[model samples]
Target: MGMHVNEVCINCDRAVADHTQKYCPNCGQPTPVHRIDWHFLGHELEHSVLHMDRGILYSLKQLMLRPGPLLRDYIEGRRGNQVKPLLLITMMSAAVVLLNRLITGGGFMDEGFSQTEAMGQALPAEALRFIAAYRSVSAWIESHFAAFTLMLLPIEALVFWLVFKRYSRLNYPEWLVVTTLLTVQTFVIWSVLVLVHRWLPQTQVLAGVLGMIYTAASLMQFFQGRPLGSTLWRTILALAIFSLASSAAVVAAVIAVMWIG
Candidate 1:
């Protein structure tokens, strides 16, 4: 049978003012109580998990089309329409990891690494050990990509905060939110380019370049009143600092592995 409206809400027993109303005014329960059926269960699951009406897809579209305005909207308290930033990042990271595994059958290491290994044949034993340790570290990173992405957010946010602190009024936590959205955008871009990589293997560098460009564009949009050149320069500076820090960490890890081995 089709849904039938009830004069009183089954959940709260509140008298619904309008017979045409879709939900109870008192408790916000649906006026038309659904029976326990496959249709109902599916609808409930979609509403609870995906919330496709105005959650992930909506946020992603806005981020992709107009990240600066979207970030400004959420930071300024117009957030009801968007999923939580951290949750979005976590979900996107998981999806990217899964997609990469599906496409590559496990981990997709750089093809150039093998060539580098061949060229390093004449190097000293210590240098050879370093190269091997670096490869091992890189493989571990690719396998735990999601965890590494999440771990980088705090430091990335710190870099943004330091670079833009004098110009913007947003605090460290707000910068964290900005970085989370940026990371989500990166993940979305990576997801698309990863599929393209099957046909065009050289697009990996393009993905990195596009991610940086999108990030710079996003900051430009987020700080509209500021001079575009100034925002661009600051963004470049922030990215440079973050890249150096991440590279240092990876090198340290590789060195540690060499010593242990």
Candidate 2:
């Protein structure tokens, strides 16, 4: 609730009320907290802040569980308990992306490459290869940050549309909400793996492999309730196509950047 000025002021000075004299004669530092504006805005703002926080927590919980019921409920107008999907997903993804950049930028070059041996008759060549690989990985990641996410999300919608083409299905926007749940899950994996990699000094290959598995499992989670064999088959095939499609899109992004720059 809002604070108030006291009625007990002496009105010590005609031009300046006792509360506004050298200091707040009422509270001793400044004028007392003005009650009018606070009474008008404070309670409403406080309620809104609490409501938004509750929505965020609910959204996060559902997002962590792939193919979670939240997306369906949210998209279907049962929106009483959660934040909008795009806002919540955007905040999570942005936080992860920032963490990745910080880790990658912290003396990232040396820890990322391997050395060559005598039988590896090209120490110089191998070093160059390592550098190129490292740069490509970083470039690809930074390139994909936000602009790429917004771009690829719709592509995912199209991919799922084709996969579920025959089912008693939802509309394009519904499929998008479904796909976003999976893609947002990837950022969670990326954020965790990157943090662990920074703290533990693991091999990049180990980091990459674990990241891939997490990504795959997150996607597979949505296909639950189908036949086990069929789910596995479709998941694998869909993953393959999605990867190819994503890669092509990434390549296109690279080419376009190169052309423009």
lDDT of 2 by residue, 1-261 (tens): 323444333233223354444555544543433455667577655554345445555456566753435555666687776666677567666766677567765422245344432335456764555445545654666555566677778887777677666642667888787667666666665667668764666433454455446445544554446555654455456556777898786556555554454
Off by over 4 Å in 1: 1-41, 44-53, 106-111
Candidate 1: residue pairs that collide: none
lDDT of 1 at 54: 64
Q: What's the lDDT for residue 10 in model 2? A: 25
Residue 41, model 2: Cα distance from true site in angstroms: 12
Q: After TM-score superposition, what is the CA distance of residue 53 in candidate 1 from its true location, in Å?
A: 5.0
Q: How many residue pairs clash in each candidate?
A: 0, 0
Cα deviation in Å at residue 160, candidate 2?
A: 1.4
